[model samples]
Target chain A: MKKAVFIKEGQVAIKDAPMPEIIEQDDAVIRVVRTCVCGSDLWAYRGDDAKEAGSDNSGHEIIGIVEKVGAAINTVKAGDFVIAPFTHGCGHCAACRAGFEGGCQSHSAATNFSNGYQAEYVRYTHADWSLVKIPGQPDDYSEGMLKSFLALADVMPTGYHAARVANVKAGDTVAVVGDGAVGLCAVIAAKLRGAKRIIIMSRHEDRQQLALEFGATDVVAERGEEGIAKVLELTNGDGVDAALECVGTHLSTETAIAIARPGAVVGRVGVPHTGDINVGDYFMKNTIFAGGPASVTTYDKAVLLKAVLDGDINPGKVFTQTYKLSDIDQAYKDMQERKTIKAMITID
Target chain B: MKKAVFIKEGQVAIKDAPMPEIIEQDDAVIRVVRTCVCGSDLWAYRGDDAKEAGSDNSGHEIIGIVEKVGAAINTVKAGDFVIAPFTHGCGHCAACRAGFEGGCQSHSAATNFSNGYQAEYVRYTHADWSLVKIPGQPDDYSEGMLKSFLALADVMPTGYHAARVANVKAGDTVAVVGDGAVGLCAVIAAKLRGAKRIIIMSRHEDRQQLALEFGATDVVAERGEEGIAKVLELTNGDGVDAALECVGTHLSTETAIAIARPGAVVGRVGVPHTGDINVGDYFMKNTIFAGGPASVTTYDKAVLLKAVLDGDINPGKVFTQTYKLSDIDQAYKDMQERKTIKAMITID
Candidate 1:
């Protein structure tokens, strides 16, 4: 079957690869249905992350149908539509028990996407804690409906957790950095959390329009100081009560810290590439900073999943472009050029 | 009247000065009843903090008798014994109302300790919100119970606020960084907050003994990695649930971060003196780092004052040495040589 493999470096291509096998007792083999590209994916493709020795697979955001399950997998069975959230989480660990399953101790599911689909089939270890089964029609779930919430497996929920960790309360104003798919989702998530005003910082016109529709009360097109000034102007110089920084670059992180009001918080979900992270800049303001891997298992997946079934938040708006599995490289190009917010590939 | 002046850098002397006079409707004149020297005071005496052009006065923690009140000072009577919490607070800023009165918008009254006592009397602006008056106290309150709850003005409440801002919960294991007066106070504060295991990292035998008396479950005499390893070994390799960093240097800050579990929080109250801070290595741990200046006005000063009155918590244990006003220079030297944890000087 075709899988998106990092053939050498700096490029991704769909090529024939050996199918994954269920070696773990609680593993589940998922037949790929729909998968989306992630921002973290660019870390390797852009030569920002360390490259693998032989070949590396490149996808963690997966929505698929279960084709097989280990004998211990009673919670989910074959022929069910499901989403794999976080990377992998052991059912028990100090972090998991404390509701921070995203930083699970014993598993490296997402980081080891070598076992995931950018392919036709993916094996999920600790399947009981990894897979969330979709309750509705298994045979007829389309990208429109699945993308609305299935994407919550990672992006939507991850960004929402960022806002939540920053303690975004009702009627509080929020500043969302990086106006990408995750940033737009955070705008929607902040609105869901009852944020009275959400200001999204973006340079792209299409993403800005989407941000406005998805509940952004204001938009700042400028980057850094100019953008922070616009946010301060909108927030009456009091600065934002909270910020969700989706882009992990130093620039976005600085902007997030710059725009937040003292005693407020910045939920930084951006995966920092190799760079110095400054926490002193936030000292006098009393800002609370918390964000790492999204604790996807901690939240009630179905609660957010319901917002989709109720047709309230259209997270699928981020899926601006679609392609077949064979043309995955072009999809990466669209995302790299910022021409597409994110890409959805049909993979039945 | 006489004033204490740092005549030469690192040297303090008593000199003739004028008595303080009320300058505004929110002002009050307080006769210095009792004052203690903080480690921060030694910063400028040792040429650490920024020095003003030929400036005098260093003390910020003062317990005094209100000698006069302005037209708007309705909170206390002229003859009241009060705790001067801030250098000054307007009591109306957003930060004030939200209880972060230390960072009040009009920061005029924030830290104007240059006009502080090293003198017979001190001028207090915004008397209504800046002072905490003891309900029942006789004249010469200093010689008797003045030292009891007065730590609430700065050290005691400041230490507790450091733990509180991180939202330290019941049964949490806490690590206290720094062995200064504030660090010892943090041991007491974290204990009061119901930390199950309180570990004090200190090399000083006196401070360690004080920490044990203040309810420390354990003590790690090591400083950096050895100290962090001891703390982790105590917690089964999971590290502390919360950390209070009372020393603000990069080393102390890193120590606090090194000793907490993922999702644990570190509340820091010490003011950073120099160098950039780095938390990039700590990003993956998902720790919530917060804290700044102790918002003494933000906490229940009256409640804590009552606690001191009830003899439930004795904060005066931190003052290991005493002196007359004439011997203050020697007191500063005693503190610098680490012979005393804190010094108490009497004006009379």
Candidate 2:
């Protein structure tokens, strides 16, 4: 089997690795069909966040075919095509029961994939609850449907988490604070939740166009104070009813908070990497700040899978570029240099 | 007429002031029947918060009789007994319509009281919406009922706001940080919302006893880390489902956040006076932080008034001492020295 490895900052390589096998009673081994590079993965690739050199298991999202299952794995079995949520859970834990599988308490590690899904084969622990079986094999679905199914593993669900936490409702005016794939997905999420007006902040023309296509009603190219001013102006100086913060930076977070109307919520889904947050500002407006890692398993089972199957949302459009497992390095490079919105990788 | 004035740190004076008249068509003049000292008022009294010397509008809460009304004040008129919420609103602005009167726009100031409620006569702005009419005159209710009506003006509703923001549900576990009048009221708020276990932090035996009487099931005397540990231990390490922050200090806020379970909300109603909040901690737990000044007008008209009128709650018990208007200085002194939980002033 071959897997992606992080050699150092700005460098990734696909190297031969041992084949994955079920090691626990609840485990299952799957042959990877599709995987992708995440914006979060870029944190380490760009040297902004540290990762040990020569580390494998470089990616988390996976749409694969289950090849084998341990004794206790009853929900999914061999020959089943599945979507594996990046964050796994036991489904029965208190947190999971409450729809927060990312904080599942019964698992030793919420995510238990051997050698990462960015490989020819991967082992998933607590397989019964972590993997969502598709109605048919990969061969039965169109290429576009397959891409949308792949998105359900993380990005689409993560973006939906922001809208859900913000309680974006019908007739709401929503503001999205990033132009990344997750932000574009959030535009869809906001629209799905019936938000009447969606304003997206995006400097890149291609990303802005995708956001508009994803249901964003307006676009503000400005950043920081100017961006907040632009959003407030768009909303007639009343600020947005809900703000989705998909960028994990102080300025982005600040802009999200600043553009939210009094008594509105700001749902932040970006992995935080910012300085002190002035809670006083949130306090004054009675703004509710809610969010964290996406509950991928819950959302995938409840909404995203159905939405994708029905072709109600085309989240796969976020993938502007594609590659094979052998070309993993160039995939990372293209995403890192802003040459592509996202990279989709296919493995055989 | 006599009104209380801030003389300096640790001092208050009852001085003769001019009679208040309705300046705006939306204003009304009331003969203050009962008023009280608040925990927030203590900030300026202790010199921790700045206030201009000799400021005469030294208080906000009031239970009074409408003695005069401007042309536009139709809902409340002369001879009506009313509860004047400290935070006034026009009742029709977007923020007010959404039940956040503290952020009400269209008014020059959300609070519009002349010469303070502690005076013999107080003028209220946006009178039609700011005043909740009692069924009968002051003479019709007992002293305890009047005290509770005054409590509805601020502390009771403010504490209820904490519980409301946290979304306390049936069978939930709630932890309250702060044991002042507002915190004590939060215990009642939590119980009213059907919390199964209500834990309150209080070192004072007097406050602890009152909290228990009000519906708190557990008491943690420790502060800071120990307090958080004690709460976690009580909940079997799962932490409380809702944490109500009633004390506006960094340590109090930190304690509230630390004892909340994953996906829980920390409802903060304390007037914030702290440094940067570590939003990263909140992010890791998917905790939602929401709150601001209580929507007293909304709560008073919708719930607190009926609750008090029906004798369903006795929030007035928080007022442990009584004083005549002439003893305004003594009221501040006793409250400052911790000799009283709250001071109830009678104007004759």
Candidate 3:
């Protein structure tokens, strides 16, 4: 089987790898149908993540068909269409039972001992707790519908998590800091959550257009203090009720904090690259900083699926570029070059 | 008039100062009936806050009798017994209207261009917005009642703020990191908010006794990782639903985060001395970090006043040592030496 491998800094290639098999009682073998490059992947691709330059599995977001299920797996069966969250969890753990599968006791994202999903076949452990089965058959969904469903595995749910943790409510004024696919999805999530005014910070015209289409009431094209000034101006100097830090940089987090109103919450879903935060400023403003990794299992994926199926949201629009499995290297180049918001990979 | 001055890094003294008078239309001249040394005051006393080594008015917490009111003052008048929140605000500002007076547009804690409360007579700006009147005449309350009311100025309200921001609810298990008066008050606040179990981390037997008396179900005598381990063990390794960070150090904040359950909130009211936070660990746990300087003006001071008046809580008990106005230096020394939980200063 062919899988994406991290060749070295600024390079990636396709290589033949051993086929994955079910090794645990709750494990399952899945044939990858669709996957994508996450912003976090850029860390390793740039050699900044300290990952040795070698052949290693990449990509965590995946939509696939269960080719085989372990005998212990009861909730899902072979031939089922499934969506795997970015992180896996053991079903019966206290954290999982409390609806925070991201903090699963036995199995978590840190202990991803299995192979990545950027391959033809992958082994998934704790299948009963980690995989969410799609209700309908593959024949019942269109190509776009399948792509949108794939977002439930990571980005879309992550955006929703940002809104949920920020306690975004009806009539709230929200600001999304970043123009990437996740930030755009946050605008949609805020809108879906009933935010009355959505402000998006974007520099690109194309991303701005998508943001507006996704329900951003306004867009601030500036960066740093100027961007915060624009948001405060839009909010009549009071700042937004909620701010979503979609870009993991310190500047973005600072901007999010700057534009949040007193008692407002700044929800960050971006993988933070910056270490320290200006806690002193945060204290004086009386703002609440919330959010981290999205607990996809805790989110109401079923409701989101219904919303997608009913044509309420088209998150697939974020897939500005697409590529066949053989052209995975080109996909990475396009994403790294900023030519695409997100690169959709077709593995089947 | 006389007032407490920050003469040097390790010293405080009572010195003659000018008599205060109303300067702004909404200002008031109040005769400070009582005042106290706050835990944060030690920051400046210890030379950690970089305050100039010269005479500058000190304390912020005060209960007083209105001596005179400006023409624009409507909510309060001369002869009214009142308590001033630690921070002031323009009641009409967006932040003030939203119940976050600490972030008021025209007024904030930093712009204390006005005089401090540690004086015989001090001018107060935004009198109508900053002062909350006691229900009855000054003569009707006992010495303990007045001290408890003074606690509402900062410590009690700040503790309550921690629990409030953490979203402490009925049946929740809470852990308070710190054994100071504010931390003990947080234990009381958590109990009042209906927390089923309250855990307080304290090394001092006196503080632990106060914590237990204030409704702490368990007291962990350990510090740092050991303290967190004790809390985790007490919670059956599930961790507490809410953790109040009453100590403003990195170790305290880390311990608070470590003992928090997934989806839990760590509410911090301490003036944070530790700069950066471990965003990576925070993200992996799916925890929410919320809180800042407690908006004392946002709290329902009337409820706290009533509780004190009715003998429901004895926050005054935390003031184990008392001194007359002329003995202000002794008060500061006792607090500086950690020989007292808090110091009470009688101005009359």
Best by DockQ: 2
lDDT per residue, candidate 1, B1-348, as tens digits?
A: 766767555677777778889898878888886777778778878876667745765677777789999998888988887888743655665555555666566665344222456567888777777788777654634443666555777898878877887777788888999889998888888888788888898998988999999999898998878888888888887777788999888888888887877777888888775256665566677878888766775564645776777777788888888777778888888998899998877776
Of candidate 1 chain B, the 10-residue stretch with the lowest lDDT total is B107-116
Model 3: runs farther than 4 Å from truth? Answer: A9-11, A46-54, A91-94, A112-115, A275-281, B8-11, B44-54, B112-115, B275-281, B301-303, B309-311
The TM-score measured for candidate 2 stands at 0.95
Order candidates by lDDT, high to low.
2, 3, 1
Docking class of 1: acceptable
Cα-based lDDT at residue A337, candidate 1: 76
Candidate 1 lDDT over residue span A100-159, tens digit each: 666676666444222436778888778877677778554566558877755777778777
Candidate 2 on B67-101: residue-level lDDT in tens? 99999977977899999888788888767877887
| Per-residue lDDT of model 3, residues A82-167, tens digit only | 88777676756667776667777777565532346788888887787778888866667898988888887888888987898898
Report how closely model 2 matches the true complex, as a DockQ value.
0.59
Highest lDDT among the candidates is held by which one? 2
True contacts kept of each: 0.47, 0.53, 0.64
Task: Give lDDT tens digits, candidate 3, residues B1-348.
Answer: 988888777787888888888888888888988888887777778887777654564578888889999999998989999988777777677677766777787765665223467778888888777788888766888888888888888899889989998999999899999999899899989998899999999999999999999999999999888888888899888899899999989889888889998778989988887667755457667778777766676574536777777888888888999888888878887998989999999885
Model 2 chain A: lowest-lDDT 10 consecutive positions: A107-116
Candidate 3, position B280, lDDT: 45
